[model samples]
Target chain A: MRLSPRTWTLIILAVLIALAPVTFPSAFYFRIGALIFVNGLAVIGLVILFGYAGQISLGHAGFAGIGAYSAALMPMHLGLHPALALFAGAVLSGGLAFLIGRPILRLKGHYLAVATLGFGILVFIVLNNEAQLTGGPDGMAVEDLGLRAVSDALGLGLRTAEVWYWFMGLVLLLGAFLALNLHTSPTGRSLRSLHNSEVAARTLGVDVVRYKLTAFVISAVYASLAGSLQALLNGFVTPDVAGFLHSIEWVTMAVLGGAATVLGAVFGATILTALPQALTVFQEYEHLLLGLIIMLVMIFLPAGLLPSLGKTLRQGESI
Target chain B: MRLKSTLAVSALAMMAANPAAAEIRLGAVLSVTGPASFLGDPELKTLEMLVEEVNAQGGINGEEVVLIHYDDGGDANRARTFATRLVEDDEVAAVIGGSTTGVTMAVAPVFEANEIPFISLAGAVVIINPLNPWVFKTPHTDRMACESIFTDLTARGLSSIGMISGQGGFGTSMREQCIDVAGEYGIEIVADETYGPRDSDMTPQLTSIAATDGVEAVVNAGFGQGPAIVTRNFAQLGIDLPLYQSHGVASDAFIELAGDAAEGVRLPGTALLVADLLAEDDPQHAVVTAYRAAYEDRFEEPVSTFGGYAHDAFWIMAQAIESAGSTDGAAVRDAIEATTGWVGVTGEFNMSPDDHMGLDLSAFRMLEIVDGGWSIID
Candidate 1:
């Protein structure tokens, strides 16, 4: 029997995660791998907001900043475990997205974009200006998540980066699985319908406001958790995590990889993450080269990498 | 498709094959291409220049030196990854260079975990305050700049001062450091104010400080053109009080931006600025002059204090390795900690168990702007 598309995507992702290390020439790649997974998880959320719901958020990194600070401050101030702090940050980000989405999501197109951008900048300013609490622009250190200790106790003998790589890979797979499942669910259909036309979906008896809010809250939680994982992995957190550029980066990754697909977002995350590591060999010209390459890709693949490639393959097959 | 194929191979290309043995590899993670590139670019150039000089002189301890470095683009996360790669992939004997305090702190845990001797070029005190065993720094801390200005203030018999600081990392840190250490020099801060990094005008903040009671002098704790704008605004407002700046603005860029207003502006800076003015018999004159001349000749640019930080970090690492007589991590770390009487472009570094950054107020020369040039006042 042929496996379902969702099953195939999960299997492929798991295989890729398990197999990528074999190609790694050194342990340094483990850190790079972990970074890709964290970023991938974030872009997956972008797929839901931008792809499924046909809405845009330019300030999702604000939620990420909130999540990262939760990991750093919660443990030190509230005496919570670093792991629990991660959860607290996710809940906080979700709740904030819900409250903010109600009024802001009413705006369409450029208005919505500006509202989200303002929200992001607001968070960045707060994180930066509240130097007394957030360590200001200098940022602060985060406590370890104690997963290394658990792995050591379990006799896994994996290194810190390696442990994080596998854990984050599992998280990304879960994120992808849920996202793929949501694509075919009844609520997912409504969300996708709104993407085509909100007015049409509303006339068809869909609760447009509730669907939009749900997508926003879910994506915010995903962004928050990704931020928490990144902070915990690096053992450091900074305001840059929640900066506007980082939010733009998430959108760039999602759009680059075909925003409508879960696996495509992951693929986008992988290339963008790995591209910088690879381009570092260019030395001083790295930024110039990175920009040129991204522009070239967008010019060629207007519909994005995965969806465009899939269409080309289908056309070829029909011919 | 060909481009995508090249992209695939590029990730693999990062995994360079390990070089031949019998060479001492020194890894560096610097902000060579980002917001802090001013600091990191000169630093990377200086380190490359130093390594070339060392190798041309026929290698240290008969082993050829290799510098494996990465441009972190001033991102802390990238700095951490590069630091880890230096430890796990390159497996260098020692590591140096984190161009900002944020980068240094982010990269510190990796070096500490791997037991690699790290010499940072950042100016934050938090880097070496608690004294991580494997970590040392080259440049004087922000606190030293604060103390240097306060020392100059006390010498001028100024008991009260007004301060304006920027909101950037270097500015706020120096401001807090100044506020923390003001009592030690018997200097009372009569007024304190702050401005954002992008604020084009500081008239509001400066006006308040000038109007404050018994304000004998004004101090600006910031880097970049922010301090230059402050100097211009001070002139515009005609606040005829002594103006002091942090070492963060110890460059020709500040003087040019402030124009005529910078004439009497005073700040603490590295000896490199006044290398030509040093006494012939001065210990640092020879080292400082030689580096400035060579760097200027080679790079076709005037030497910066940021480059001086890298110069000091490199020399300190070399001296530690030479003293230890091996490339072993623990030995090099201990040797770096035990360093003493080592003179470099920055200052005479004297490392110890308790003090990883071993510079005092004397390391900073109180420089005054005179006719668009730096003049040593103390």
Candidate 2:
């Protein structure tokens, strides 16, 4: 029996995901793995925005901040469950994206980038300044998601981080599958068209404005989900989650791993997530190396690592 | 297929052979990278040096101190993640870290929830207030520094002062405390101004303060780029009025970064920096000299207040663990809480549950720059 490409991808992902845990030296590695998945989830959203739709956001961390703060504040203040707060964060992020995207998306290139930057800075300033409500710069506590309790009740033993790692990995897989499906859908086609040439897409009745807004809102939801997962996993939140540097780091991860491909984004996230641990010896040189990698990758592999490698492989096969 | 299967089997065999090892792991979630990188970088080095020192001295009660260090990149969320990992996975004996108040605050609750002992290098008073029994601080808080500064200003007969601070957690906290403490000294704040963290030129703020009527002295609070810039601005404007810097400028980096402008700048800080100026008979002199020599020999850099605090934090923890006779978090917390007359590189630490800040105003001395080095002012 032959497997279709989608089925083959799923099977491969499942095998890798299941087998990865076996190599852990300690449960510490599980927490790191969970961290990678949470960050990967955010990068996947960037792939939808930058890779598929050709939209740039320098402030996606703002949505992530909203998601994290929601997960933290709503559960404590409103007495809502953490899972419900995660949904509330996503909805809030979506609504924010909708309201801000309408005017901001109309601008092109650097103007749009600056406007989005402003929006992110605005959110960050609010979170940082509203000390009494948000616990100020000192940050606040987040409620646990109770996944460990559920596993305990079911007689399935798992560490706190192990559960979060597996859960987040499953969520990432689902997010990737949905994003891949969207890449081949009619709406995805319109987004790609608009990405290539907005004027031409408009002429072809692609409804460029609506498609762009849709992509922004969808990506915001993804970022919000990633943020909520991070808050849940760490059981804490702070305004720095929505800071400018974090926003840049997420974009860098997506662009570095070949934003055009789901697998590439995941690969990028994983590499970055693990690089700091591996480069512990080069303590001072870490930042220099990171800056150099970003520069070299942009210069040499403009389409990113995975996409460029795929192109080379295809050409070699043809030869 | 056979090769792949063989490889998989070998990988599984390797994993199974390596069992999880139990050690008294301690986590240091620090700002190893970012604008606050200087603080975290030295901290990491100091921590490494301390670990080596402890292990060389036969470890903590026969159990090796395994440090699980994480770079917060000066982000609070990353700090929290590292703290959680330390508590939930590494099962750290105590989590020590957070170069800045923001990161420390972010990670404190995780320590509180898990009942893991935490000690912060950040000097924010709120860090230990409404105190979680699990949390304690080594560096003197801003409130103490503010009180000391106000006392010094009163002695100097400077009753009217101008204020300038950077707009950040440390800066805002220090500024607020200074304002509150100034009233007790009958000191009036004639002018007040603030600059953002990224602001390079504080000339506008300084110039504005200089213009204020009857301002006898200027109190500048903030660290890193902000203090350096403020110092240069004060000098350039030819403001002969005495300029008082917060203890945040108690590093050689400030003198080097601020150039000639740092000369004559009065500041308040722990006794460590000016140990050489202390009488040879003073009890703290010997410890200070030894710490300075050891640190300089190790890192090839002059000892700053950061290194002093980091050294104190590690030594104090070691002492607590020794007193507890175990690595239990509760035992260590109890030992630390009951600390008294614990002489360290910084000052003699005396902690109680009511005051997690071990050192009070008496632990600090007024310092002024003379000939490009810190000198005892009073």
Q: List RMSD in Å for every model shown.
A: 2.4, 4.7
Q: Quote the positional error of residue A126 for candidate 2 in Å.
A: 5.5
* Candidate with maximal DockQ: 1
Residue-level lDDT tens digits of model 2 in B1-378:
222332342242122222244456777888988867878888888889889988988788787888778887888766766676667655678877888887887788778877877889887777787787888888887877778878888898889999998777668778888888787879899999999889989888888999989999999888667988999989999999998888877877789998999888988877787877888887688888988888889889877777677888887788888899887888999988888988777678889988786786777789889889988866
Provide per-model DockQ scores.
Answer: 0.45, 0.30
In candidate 2 the C-alpha lDDT for residue A181 amounts to 85
Instruction: Provide the lDDT at A219 for model 1.
Output: 96
Candidate 2 segments whose C-alpha is farther than 4 A from its true place: A1-26, A70-85, A99-138, A143-159, A196-200, A278-319, B1-27, B54-68, B84-95, B109-116, B154-161, B180-191, B198-217, B228-242, B252-265, B369-377
lDDT of 1 by residue, A67-164 (tens): 99999999999999999999999999999999999999999999999999999999989987788788887789999999899999999999888899
Q: Write the per-residue lDDT of candidate 2 for residues A1-319, one digit (tens) a residue.
A: 9876556555655666677887776665687778878888899899999988999999999999999999999998999999999999999999999999999999888988888888888888988877667866767778889999998998889877688878988998998888888888999999999889988999998988899999999999999999988978877677888888888888888988888877777767876776765565576688899889889999999998767766777788899
Clashes of 2: 1
